[model samples]
Target: MSPRQYEDDDAESLPDSRFLLPQLRDADTEDVEKYQRGGLHPVHLGDIYDGRYRVVHKLGAGGFSTVWLARDDTEHRWVALKIVVADYSTSVSTKSQLSCHAASRCASDAVFGFVLERRHFTLDGPNGRYLCLVLPVLGPSASDLSKGIYSRITPSLSRRASYQATRSLADLHAQGLCHGDVTTANILFGLLNIDRYTESDVYRLFGAPETAPLETESGETPGPEAPKYIVKSLNFLSSIESVISQDVRLIDFHQSFLISLPPEQMLGTPAEFLAPEVAVGLKASPASDVWALRCSIFRVRSGEGPFSGFEVTSPVDLLRIVIQTLGEMPSSWGDTLFDYYGQPTKEPTKGSPLEPVVETGRVRLEDRVWKEDKKKPYPPCLSDTIRKPTATKINNSYIDGYSYETDELLEALPKISENEAALLYDLLSKIFVYDAQKRPSAREVLSHPWFHMGEL
Candidate 1:
């Protein structure tokens, strides 16, 4: 089989795949073996890869990949290098799509109102050979922005961020692409230069890594490496402090889907942003991206998403939250109950979380009720207010510990002009509608009154 064909099954075997810290490399034979098993490369403070980029410091790590800030010695610029298992790397078809997307636009474009630059190639890491992608170095993510300095994005900043995100999505949609994951973490601020702030200041402000050495059994200790360059002037941080109007870009397209591909092949998104159609087994589409966009914009404007207060322990709980937040499943979804080949459905697993969901098929429990979706199979006569559940034991595992007063989306939304508020509500409602067909396209969303309100 091709490398891409074996990726899904093999991803688990290489679970802890990340670049090994310099301290762990010579510790012992066991440490070496562990690094090999986890597919961690022997990357250290000063290693150069592909005869060009020099490792600077770690950016961050995920289960399947590790990103590092590297200086391109050839180009004399800072860039992000993301290393992943060869099997889990982007496929030929995906590369084609990314290339097509790249050729269709300039390196920096007015349409997107943001930068989206990337370059990918294969590299031989210490544990095993891997695939690496080289990308432009950018600043803190939108989630970082929200949780950091401002506590929450101001109303004006939120408007600009949402507009950029929607316009970016519209550009991708025009090419028939769906960015599978569209959350705050995937949105990043544009930075002019990494040299603008001192290393200590950058570490304090953005939490960039400063090396920490590990103790060795042999007692041959090496000191932490100092950064190659440091800035003497620190005026840039203050100058750019009020620049919330700067560009924001959507990123992390590893899970992105091509609309032309078979529905079964598309991967699911982060649970919190998963659309109703996706949870129920329908293929993800551009409309599903619209759903995620709405959720992201909501979190940006308000401090939480509509269903933010729910404690979702699994995919099933996510579905319950969807049903509770939005009304009952669409009437059109009834046709999706059949088997994949259009055959009759089999009986659902008994006592499963799905059991309660499917059994309560068309019933609309009171809109926006707390702890309502978990009740067991209901009786013919049921009172909405009663705490006692009938024969069914309500799954209280999804309890959200958040008090009502602390929910920013419900309580702390920034006050805005009535005209802007009305336009925002109408735009969000159109995308949040339960039926995927009824949801507006990304282009349609970009044209909404809220986006055009400045013109009026």
Candidate 2:
């Protein structure tokens, strides 16, 4: 809920979404010529090389560090390595930023680093805590998938999206790890070809009287072989192929703590995704994981970022959104709406990031916020300043802004949460006694709430 730990005097050094993730660029090296390289320039962070994860090319740079999709030549696998290097020489704020990344990585690697340590290495960087940890390379994040481009097959594929995501979450539960970041781009799908069956089966899954434009030439309802079913399912957010790829595994232990703590007291998640307890600094448990997942599923359903409006970017406001909307976090689905957006969260604050940057015809949401008053109505795309934010950008900035979007971004994660998502958050409380010593083991979290809901 609070901004990352920083000295009060060293404020004003934090970065926002627009500034955090530099454009994704392929590392221009001779080793990867065969593979397609996305056009982007590498930005350096930290002291550079981390043993096996040599700084090949930078994918994107952020406040804590730069994320580079590098080849683990020694280990023989593609990896997304984060290097936290800030110029503390001149800027005390830069040093603080580097320290924050180190603490977070320490917290994360303390638990999950070993999951791949034998397969990888953890060497020291220039700074004491500043180190490089490696995890498998991921395709574009859920935000990219939302913008469309996670798959090549299945012209349309959505039924598989939920199933894939649920199954992935179930997999995470099997392990003690929970994927805190569960947005669309993070939910990468494997290859899925629904048309391997006959064409008739296709219509059975997706003959919507609602959207698809049936061609005049085709007389009968499209069959299983058709991609229409997949396309119909996307609903502008994702396609079936993309959904199937959304299976989640434990990654990014930065925010995740070892499986301990009371259910309601879980802390350290982003504002949008933070369980009710996280803001107050309580222990997190399986039930808290469920709460995070429920919000994520809703994000998948709606293509847009969770609660796009309202500038309440702080953690306090985000938890207010959760408490205000769906009552207390539940162990099961809220009223069984596949996912529940719940209720009206607080409106954006005047100090929020959506402050206007430019103008078109009428005033936009940015306009209202920019001038520090009610934004005048304006057509979409008022200007760069008034434009809507990208999910990952908002997700990244929510923490910097301490805005409600933290939880909103959490809700929109495309990956799956670690333990089984519950109808209520208290289920974790019952399983993990309030007394920290009696809290359930990370292993227990998986079976306690496993319902095989991915079939949905």
Candidate 3:
């Protein structure tokens, strides 16, 4: 049976737990001042907005916005209502972010592209106004699913999800855009049974005043009051059959940026998922997104990132792992000193507006390559080194004698077929190239043989 059918038949028997939305924490002094400046107002179940959307429950919250599962009386369906905290919308950067989001909506209709589109409307509050974005209610995020499902995701499922994600990224890249943050949390499943009520009932209660009354089998308008649908603890992901047919969608464009413009901020997730170029103070590009995408694919399949489980968990260690696993950084690029925030600088001076310069431990070019006898041996130039890599004089210092083998990082990877494993490794290496210029574009990666492994 369809998920919606099950929801319709069982909704009445389910306990009314819609009010279980966790109470919003009290706003801090700064947030209070922002709200006083017309930022946002408290929302609760049953609260009406713009005389149309009725709040049903909270969906989730982020650093700058809160999403609620709201019923759009005009459309007579469920929609996700995202409200940017009032104060943030006032910032110039936030305006640019919203513009990027608006552009993403245009690409959502493209074949294979899956950006969460926003509806038109700016909701006004008494103290602080808000930029209201109405979107389709989607299921759990990829991160949530990954945690629950763990390593059970099959190769076919991985290929399909990755294929869709690549197409989405390629679409963005074609438009000179970059999803600055492409973590699993921003990817969600497109599931059913999100809303419990039938459209007929919704029309009867909130349909247009001038429209004809909603017709029933008995040819009569229902009572003015209808029982509200309750929000229950949904195990939707668990309920979904282990099939490779399902698709994923990309959401959250607040961090998206245009590649043609100068980057305004350092973006992307922490150590494990960050791109090599991003780690070494370079502007984000489509290739950076590719890097994150590769990391995400690995995490979804293996349950952890390449550099996640090390005893020494620091940015320096991450860099070390990258060098060991991916080979030496380009000679010229390797020696370049970046400010703490990964921005290139002439000199590594302390307190020099650099966030925290990457610690380029004393790397010797000779050490980067493995001997001919070693597994995964380096090229013939293994003996070509003259000087130690100059370390940035920042708070964090790199270890002089530190070294690693590529197998150290690959050991935790899941065991697959020899051909499948080789294809996967080759694809990852291409995207994770030390030089961003050499990294394959989303379209190029999409055309790789790994994705066409029969199941596709």
Error of 2 at 2 (Å): 18
| Candidate 2 positional error at 139, Å | 0.3
Q: Rate the local accuracy (lDDT) of all candidates.
A: 0.56, 0.35, 0.56
Q: Candidate 3: list runs displaced more than 4 Å.
A: 1-41, 90-112, 124-127, 148-151, 193-235, 238-245, 310-317, 333-415
Give the root-mean-square deviation of each candidate in angstroms. Answer: 13.3, 18.9, 18.9
Model 3 gets an lDDT of 0.56
Best by TM-score: 1
TM-scores for every candidate against the unseen true structure: 0.67, 0.42, 0.63
Model 1, span 1-456: residue lDDT tens: 333545665676664522233432111111322334335344566678888988766665554556677778787777888776445654522743563474366334743443344566777644556777787776556665452112355556677778888888877777666777788878876665564545454455444444434333354442222122221111112231332235687777767667786357424466778777776667788888889888888887665666554654344556666776676677665443332221223334211223335432322222333333333322222121111221222232322323453343323323568988888888887787778899988777776767665531
Query: Model 1 scores what on Cα lDDT?
Result: 0.56
In candidate 2, position 52 carries an lDDT of 56
- Tens-place lDDT per residue, model 2, 1-456, is 122333332356642212111121221121111111121112232223455554433344333344554555575554567544323212323322332343344444333221232232333332323345464544333343332111121112322343445444444444444444443434543323332423233233323212222221324543322212111111212122231333333334343433432334334355565555443344565545555554444444334334333333444455445444445444332222111122222233211221122322321232321211112222222121111222134434422222354556545534334343342243334432223344443334334333333442
Error of 1 at 135 (Å): 0.6
Per-residue lDDT, model 3, residue 101, is 56
> Which lDDT value does model 1 have at 311?
54
lDDT of 3 by residue, 4-113 (tens): 56568778776442122222222111122222344445554677777888876556656566666678898778888877776665552464455455455555465335
* Candidates, ranked, TM-score: 1, 3, 2
Clash count, candidate 2: 56
